[model samples]
Target: MTDCDFLLVGHGIAGATLADVLRARGHRVLVYDPGQANSASNVAAGLMNPVAGKRFALSWRAEELLPAAAAYYRALEQRYSQSFFTETPIFKIFGSPEEQNAVLARSADRPWGDFVASLTTTDPNLPGVHAPFGGAWLQHGGHVAVRELLAALAAEGHRAGWLRRESFDWTQVQFDSEGATYAGQVRSRHVICCEGAAAVRNPYFGWLPLTPNQGEVLDVECADLSPAQVLNRGAYVVPVGGGRFRVGATYRWPPFAPGITAVGREELAARLTVITDLPFAVVGQRAGVRPAVRDRRPLIGPHPTVPNLSFCGGYGSKGVMLAPRLATLLADWLVGEAEIWPEASVQRYNALQPAGVG
Candidate 1:
């Protein structure tokens, strides 16, 4: 059997980032990804959100996560000589007077004061848009074209002789206290499972409370909208280059259904109508299942009993914002230099883990 430092499953943002993090530190990494159609990272717009929801509350630890994530993507962009991440400000239109008031109050406080600006009127230069209740200018965050980024990283990994373009069968994996061996073809010093929404089927981590959710987004050509600005009114419209914009993301939580539907398309169109009245051509629609968790936090770190096996997923809608930072922490933890953040550690559910079967 061939030996390697890590054998990663799933090449979504979680796996791809974790693979790169570990590889950068001098580990021999082999990633398994057949590029599943329903992979969330593939279908995500990869928005880097600093402020979340209607309350205008600071995204969980935005102070630490946002800047570092931008830097990480920038560093990779430089190394690969490819562009994917873009720093585009989101113009959040207020749907009600209450929503406008929340932004006004939050933008006056410390930190929150620094993240957004309450806008009383739409900029005259930005046309094809109208906000009746005013809006908020989110001063931080951007978007990552996830599919391109993953392909670029995978190309580098393949060139370096580390990536595998095949599915990993659980039946062929043997895990012991020491580590894991796959099909007796590669003996891994550590195995990390980054399976996005598919983590519900992970026999090794079934107890982690992984909940899958489906979301759909539409690609439309809007020539009149500002290409540099992302506009949101509950739903978002982000420019994805070539004069085309991506509008989307309707959340279908738990009871997890699969695939795209006409209903989803109609719902997005209605939401987009509320966000903007611009004339546009519908170009495409895509759907994927988000690897959401019941607690709505990430799951990282090694198996409680197995020791060498680990997990890094369940970032859900926040995958782009959280992946890099969490991947760095997991990399350090792998080398015995640090511990996973307690809030994000798989250990959080240790009390619920059934013993002797990790």
Candidate 2:
């Protein structure tokens, strides 16, 4: 059997980042990626906003994740000789006077004041935009070119002999205290499943509350808008390139199919309507299933009952901002250099099954 220190399933952001971190620490990691259709990383807009929701509250652990993501992605850009991460500000349009007041209130708070600023009454000078109630500018964080980053990571994995571009069969895997053997063709000291929403089907990890979310995005050509920054109302518009902006992300639980639906498209269009008046043509549409959790926190670390088996998924909508930082933390924990963050540890779930039967 081909031997390695780690066997990674699902080469999405979580898996890709973890493999990168471990390899940097001098470990041999093999990644198995079936390349599933509608994987979240492939379809995500890659927007990283420090302030979230209408209340404009700071995102969970924003202080740590923001800098960590920026540094990690920047380093990857240097190593890969490709540009995928862009640091830009987000202009959050207030839908009502109440929302505008909320931003003002939050901005005066201690740490929140560090990243928030109220925009002047003057127009933002963007055509086809309506923000009568004004908006606020989030001074930190940005978006990543997720599709490009994933492709680069996959290339890096292949070049390093760490990536297997095929589906891994759980039924064919045999597990023991020492390690895991897959189809007798691969053996590893630890198996990390970064299967995203598909982990809900994994027998060993299905028991965890991996809530699958169906999200959709629209790729539209809007040259009249500024590509220098992102626009946010009820929805977000991210400038991808070539006068095309990526708009989207409607979250729906259940009916977790990857295909786009008429309802989803209509909802996204309506949300975009509130953000801009400039007419834009919808050039493309995309959708994927994100691995969300009830607590909205990521899952990391070894299984409570299974030896040499670990998990790293459930970054959900925040995968781009969360993956690189958590990946380093997980790698450190795996090599016995540190402990998994309490919120992300799998042990938080009291009902982890001994096997996937649940």
Candidate 3:
């Protein structure tokens, strides 16, 4: 007999979020985490914005995702008796007159009123920031303390005897007539891999088009910038607390190293300068690989042949807002309550791989 209902092979946002959902439904879940120091969830700023880019386009499924994220995190807070998610709006400064006009155009044509909370022009004399063309308030946007969420949720799981503080060995996982076996002892009815960018190293699901990108961000301490909201111009400045903000987030394809580079710092500093004239000191820096995919959609669902083995990853930068909603769906699917979304299902990529491989 299987020792548990589910064996979760990661402890990042994707796995942790799903575990919460499944456990709430009374499923037996065991999580194995290697405690990777540089996991993306550990280093992420955890910002969830509805509108983005120079044109201020609405993010994918913003209407549905924003509310779901807010509700889920709020529930998590009540469960943990801790505070983490903050509903801070984003003040996206316009770069140029043309860009300002572009936003106005988007607001008129698109239903931007739903996500673009407010829009206004700059006074030019505005202190600290260089917003001559003005900015907009992105509504229903906020940042989740991902590190806190992971830590708190892990603690909860550990207390409930569902969290294992160790790396999962894929070689030790065996699928047979009974179910999935791991470490030659523990047996599970199902195993879901949520290994983030590390999934690229997975032999079974590695065949998926996962483009792990290296992202670097700087934690800065600037007393002059606004802590009430996030500043998005050339780069983002998210308030971490008193006089400190998380900034930068350069995306480099084929990420080389785990350490922060001089080039990344310089590039971020250049953008930070454009955002404001106030001097700020870099208090800390972090780097991690985002589990992004070529299709830019989430990777989910069970293996084609091995029904007990599944995956839930490729969330990339939107893990905070995306994971919970997708996890709910996956949980429903696991219980035979619903089917997986086609776009995120592993079967969608089955044709590209050799027969029988997930």
Candidate 4:
């Protein structure tokens, strides 16, 4: 039998980063990921947008999250000797004149100014796109090769003898006063479930309102698009490399179903012309489930009743920008050095609906 300090039951951004942080702090960690087909991290476009949504408001804790994410991914890239993060600009097309004025007004402020590189009116003459309504080039935004980063971390964990490429059977979990045992072979002082969109079925944390949001993306090839540019008009067209771009994504809520759909493709295809006039050949299509919560905040902290059991999920599309910082916070809390954010803490839900989780 082997004993460790933590057993993480997922390898998405949250689990992988948390494991790395814990291991860096000299804690024994065992990460389990079966690589589900519906993994959002695997199929996500991994956009690190500091200013998101219709109001163009700064993301929650954007100042801290954005730079922290950039620095963290950079460190991961250097450690793995791979390229995964790109600090590119987001040329966000405005919808109307009112929208443009609002953006410009915010750009004059201190914090918003830091992210607003330049503002465009009636269109910024960028290639391959028809932005008649103009756009703003948002700085400190970038794309993260999420699948690549997850794969890299998995390989490193395998090399370090802390990650398992297999499924964790909850039936085998036996909790004691101190920790829990897996299949009577491995013992961990704590078990944290970072099961992304599949968390709706997580028995311990199922009570939380983890709405599974489905998003589908398309990979297209074009001859004239620049890989250095990212065009954002709600749904974005991100250049991957070598005349290839990723056009996404369709946010389907509730009655969620897995896999790509023809309707989603048609929707993106129709909107593609609005974003750009360049002809493109659809190279590939992918769909994944984002673990979106009811309140749109991440689910973090321990179960209300289960000892040494915790849940970390519900990051939705913001996982790329948010996971590293949240993971660090959870790590600090785990070792008694800090408290979890009240908004993101699972305790909020437990307080309201203690009997909600099955």
How would you encode candidate 3's per-residue C-alpha lDDT over 1-358 as one tens digit per residue?
4389989989999999999899889988888998887899998999998888886778777788889999999998988899889998888998888888889878754557888877887643445878888888887889999998899988777787789888888988889766688977898989999999999888788888888899999998889786888889877888988889999698988838667888888888889999888999988889888999887889899877765888999999989989889999999998889998897787888866666564
lDDT of each: 0.84, 0.86, 0.86, 0.87
Stretches off by above 4 angstroms in model 2 are: 352-358
Worst 10 residues of 1 by lDDT: 117-126
Candidate 2 per-residue C-alpha lDDT over 1-358 given as tens digits, one digit per residue, 9 for 90 to 100: 7999999999998998888898888998899998764689999999988888876768888889989999999998998899988998888887787777767766878778777755644456666678887778787778999888999888877887888889889898888989999998998999999999999999888889899898999999877877777899888999988989998889989965659878888888888877877788888899999999989999998887768999999999999989989999998888798999999888898475754452
What are the per-residue Cα lDDT tens digits for candidate 4 across 1-358?
9899999999999998899899999999998889775589989889988887678888888899999999999999889899999989998889888888888778778788888898878766677788887878899989999999998888888888898889888878988889999998999999999988777787677678888889999999987865677887868888898898899889999786668999999988887877778888998999998899888888899888878998887899999999999999999988888999999999988855545443
- C-alpha displacement of 279 in model 4, angstroms? 0.8
Model 1 pairs whose backbones collide? none
TM-score of each: 0.95, 0.96, 0.96, 0.96
Give residue 136's lDDT in candidate 1 (0 to 100): 76
Q: What C-alpha lDDT, on a 0 to 100 scale, does residue 49 get in candidate 2?
A: 89
Score residue 22 of candidate 1 by CA lDDT. Answer: 87
* Location of the lowest summed lDDT over 10 successive residues in candidate 2: 349-358
Query: lDDT of candidate 1 vs native?
Result: 0.84
Enumerate clash totals for all models, in the order shown.
0, 3, 0, 1
- Residue pairs whose backbone atoms clash in candidate 4: 123-134
